[model samples]
Target: MTHGFRVASLCLSLGLLVSVVACHDNKPAAETRPAANVDVINVALRDVPVVFEYVGQTESSQQVEIRARVNGFLEKRVYTEGSLVHAGDVMFVMDRKPFEAALDAAQAELAQQKARLVTAQANLDRVRPLAAKNALSQKDLDDSVGQEQAAAAAVEGARANVIGATLNLGYTTIVAPVTGLSSFAKKQDGSYIDATNSLLTYVAKLDPMWINFSLSENEMLDLRTQTQNGTLKLPPIGKLEAVIVLADGSIYPERGYIAFTDASLSSETGTYLIRAAMPNPTGSLRPGQFVRIKLLGALRTSAVAVPQSAVQQGPRGAYVWTVDKDGKAQQRAVETGEWNGNDWVIKSGLHPGDHVVIDNTLRLMPGVPVKANLVATPPAAVNIGGPDGGATGGQQAGAAGASGPAAANANAGANAGTTAAQPTAASGASGALGEHTALYFASGSSSLDAQSADALAAVARRLVAEPGMRVAISGYTDSSGSQAANQRLAAARAATVRAALVVAGVKIERIEMRKPAQIVANDPPDKSRRVDVMFSPAAGG
Candidate 1:
C-alpha cells in the first residue's frame, strides 16, 4: 500500500512540471524579448577630404661644410660647438704666423720687381735717345727695350702674387659661409689642417627646412586610377599642404607645400620621392628627424562614411548594423578605408539613405526588431588624433561647409538637428602665467627657436607687469647619444631660457635654474628634449 501511494505522488509531480513547461512555451514573443533601442544615422554620399600620411625626414635646405681654405695649424675654435652662428661669424682661426710670413715675402718680392722695372725704364730712356742719334748701336736700344718690357711683366706677376697672398692670409680666419646652426669641430685646436683633413665643421641652415617623403608604386597607381575614374580630386601640387607631426604627437605650427616630385621612381627604394619646403623661421626643426607627414587637400567625391564606433569587426570582416525597411536589425559587411577624424571611410557595402546604427550596436542581432532614433551624422572633417576636433598635425579639411553644392547639401542634411559651437582660446595671459610652459628644442641643441623666444618674451612681459612673479626653469634630454652630453645639453638649454628671459627685461635674480627631473630610458626624444618654466609669486619658491 505504501509503494502504490509513492508511485501516484511521482505521477502527479511529473504532470505539474509538464503543465508549467507548456504554459511557458505558449507565451507571446513580445513578453519574452522587446526591440532594442538604437541610434541611427542616414548614410549620405559627399565629398570627403583625405590625408595621405607618409614617414618623412627633415633636411636642411642648405648644409654648408666649413673646411679650411688654406693648410695651417688650427689655432683655436672661435665659436662654440653646436651653437647658432650668423653669417660671417668667425668659426676657426688657423695659425696666422705662416700666412703672415708668406704675405710679407710676396710684398717684398713685389717691391723688388717694381725697383727693377724702374731701373730698366731709366736705362731704356737713356739708350733710346742715343740710338736715334746713332751714338749707340741699335742693338743696345733694342736690348734696353726688351729689358724694360720683361721687368714690367715681372712687376705685374709680382702684384698678382701679392694679391693671392693677401687672400690666403684672409683664409686663415675661417668665417661661416651662411647663417645656421654649427656642428662640432672636426679638427681640434693645435691640429694640422691639411688638404686631406680640411673639414673643420658644418653649418646647417635652419630656416626653410626641407622635408622628404616617398610614395610607393602601388599607392601612386591607386591614386591615378581613382583620379581617372573621377573618384579622387587633387588640388594643384602647390596648393596641397604638408604638415608634420613630431615624435611626441605635437603638430609643427608651420605648414608647408609640395615643392618637387621626382619624375622617375627611385630604383633603390622603388618609390617616387617627393619633397616639401617648410618655413622654419624659428630653427625648431633639425635635420634627420623622422616625422609623420600628412598631405592634405585631396578629396574623395561621393564617398560614403560612418562613425568609427558604428563599425564592428567579426570573424568574416568589418561590419555595421543597419535598420532595414522592416524595422529589423541587419548585419552588413563593409570595406573600410582610412580614418577621417572620428569617422571611418566606407569603401563599399553601404548606400545613401541607409540607416546605419551608430549606437546600441552590441545588443543587436540579425532579424531582431529595433526601435531606431535618427541622429545627426558627424561632420566630414579630418581631425585625427586630436581632442578638440582640430587637426593635430594638419589643417582641418573637407569640413561640411566646404565649397561645392553637393557638400553644402550634405552639410545641411547632416546638421539639421544640431547647432555647431565655435571653439574659444583655452588660456589667456593671466592663466598662462599661473602654469608651467614647456619650450621644446631640437635634438642635441640648446638654441631657442622663434616659438620658444616668443614664449619667453610673454613670460618676461608678465614678470615685468607683476613684480612678485618669479620663474624656475628645468631642462631635460633624451637618452640618445651620451649621458655626459645629454647632461650638458640639458643644462645649456636651461641656461639659454634663463638668458633669454633676462634679455627680455626680466630680472636675473628673480629667475632660478632648477635641475631636471630624472627621465625614463624609453621616453620619446621629442618629450625629453624640452625646458620647463614654472612661474611663482613667492621669491623663494
Candidate 2:
C-alpha cells in the first residue's frame, strides 16, 4: 500500500497471478480499483389499461308462462317436465262434453233451416216464369218471395253459431305458444284449472343463453382515455372473448361474445347493462346461474419497473440506487406507482437501462460490490417487466427501446471513478434556504464513504437556515462485493449521514432512514451505494 493518497496494488480473485514491472521515473499517480458493479435506470410513467370485468347471471333469451285458456277439469300433460316442446304443442286436454253438445244442437238447427231455404228457392224459380205469363196473382208470388228470403237469412245465422261452438270445443285443448323447455305443470288430473286459475307452468328457450352485466360511468371514461392515449390496447370487435368462472373457481371453457349493450345508463346503479350470448348446446348452463365474467382487454404501453428495495426515501422525496461509470454508487430520485410485489412500477425518474436490486435487499448500497446471481430475468411474470430471453416492457416501444440490466451494470462501472464537479453542482443551488445533499462512502468502499459525515453536516447547516425546509437522503453502494455486504454498507452510509446531521444541529425527528438498493456487481456495488438528500417546500424559497 502506498501512503498519502498515492498507493497502488491489486488483488486478483480466481487464481491469476501477475506482476507489473517497476517504472524507472516515478511521478506517482492515484490508483483506482476495478469496479464490479453495473448501472441501471428506473423511470415513472402512467400505464393505463382497458379492463372488462363484471358479474352476471345466465338468462334465457325467451320465457313464457303457460296458462289455461278455458274452464275445465285438470287433464293429462302432453309433454314431460323440462322437456323441449315445439310451438303449438299440446300441453293440456280438458273435458269438452258441454261444448260438443252445443255444437251438435247448432248443426241440427242449421240443417232444419237449410231445408226451408231449398223449398223457397224452388218456388222463386217457378214464380219468375209465372210472373212473365201472368198465370198467378202478382201479390201471391211476392208473398212466396218474402218467405224464401226469411228462410235464407235464418240458415246463415245458424251456420255462424255452429262455427262458434266448434271453436269453443277446441279451446279445451291447451297448446304451447313457442318452442322451449316446459316446467312441471301445476294443474293435475281431477283438479279444476282454467284461464282464471293459477299458472300451470313455464317454458324457456335455452339454445343461446344471455349473460348480463353492468359497467359504471367511471369505467367507461377510463376505457375512452386509454383508447385516446394509445396505451391500453383493443381487442376484436363483437368478437371480444371472455372467460366464465363458476363459484367453484374452475374456468369455463365455453366462450361468450358481446351480444348487446344498453343505449343509456341506468339511474339506479349509474351503470349501463351489457349482455353476452353464449352457446349452450347441451344445455349445461341453467337460466339464472350466477357466474363471474373475466374479459381480457388490449395490451398496455411500455413501462419500466424496479424492486422496492432499490428505492430509498431521501430529503428530496423517493429515489433509487443507480450504479454510474467507474462502478460507483449514485442516488437517483424516482417516481413510482402500483406495487408489483417484488418490484415497484416506476412512473417517472427512471430510464431504459438500469441495474436494480431484486434479492438480498439487506446487502444493497450505492457503491458496494454485489454479485448478481446471473440468472436470467423471467419474461412472463403476469405483467412483470421482462424475460430472461431479454424481452421486457408491456408496450412494444418499451420492449424495443429499453435496455436490459446488463447494460446498466456496464454503465455504472464506467461512471464510478469520476465525481461530479463540485463547483458546478453547488452553483446550481437556487437560494440560501435551499440545501444540497451528496452521498459519501466508506474508505476504499465507494459503497458509502466514511466522509459522508462532512456532506451531511453541510445539509444540516442548510436545514437550520431554512426552518420550514425538509431534506431527504438516499444511500447506495458499488457492486464490488457480495450483495448482502453491499446492502448493509449502503444502509450504514445513510445512517452516518443522518448522524452527521444530528450532530450538526439538525433535529433527529426530522430525519428519516430507508432500506438500501440492491445493485448487482462484485466490484463496484460500493460505488452504487449512496444516500440522496432532498428538500421540501421547493427548498430555497
Model 1 over residues 1-541: C-alpha lDDT tens digits? Answer: 9999999999999999999999999987675587899999999998888776554667899999999989879999999999999999999999999889999999999999999999999999999999999999999999999999999999999999999999999999999999899989888899998899999889999989998765545456656767899988999899989887775567889999999999997553345667899999999998756555678898888889888899999999999999999999999999776566767788789999999999888899899999999989988887534222332111112111122333233223212211111112212222333456667777657755534433444454355445677877777756656878788889988877775555333567899887665467676557677777776785343
Candidate 2 residue lDDT tens string, 1-541: 3553342233342213322323423548778554443334333343433224344566788888887766777667778887888899998777878779989999999999999999998998899789879998898689889989999999999999999988888877878887777887777877887556847888887777887655445445555665687755666647676556654445566877887878997653345677888877777776655555545444446757565556677788887766544455556787654343344556677776555544444445666654443333333122212111111211111111112342233223212211221211322122232334556454534233323332333344355444565655555555565777767767766765665454333566676564554445453543374456655554322
Error of 2 at 239 (Å): 2.8
Off by over 4 Å in 1: 1-39, 119-145, 326-328, 362-376, 384-541
Estimate the overall C-alpha local distance difference test score of candidate 2. 0.57
Q: Model 2: how far is 509 from its true place, Å? A: 43
Candidate 1, residue 206: Cα displacement in angstroms equals 2.2
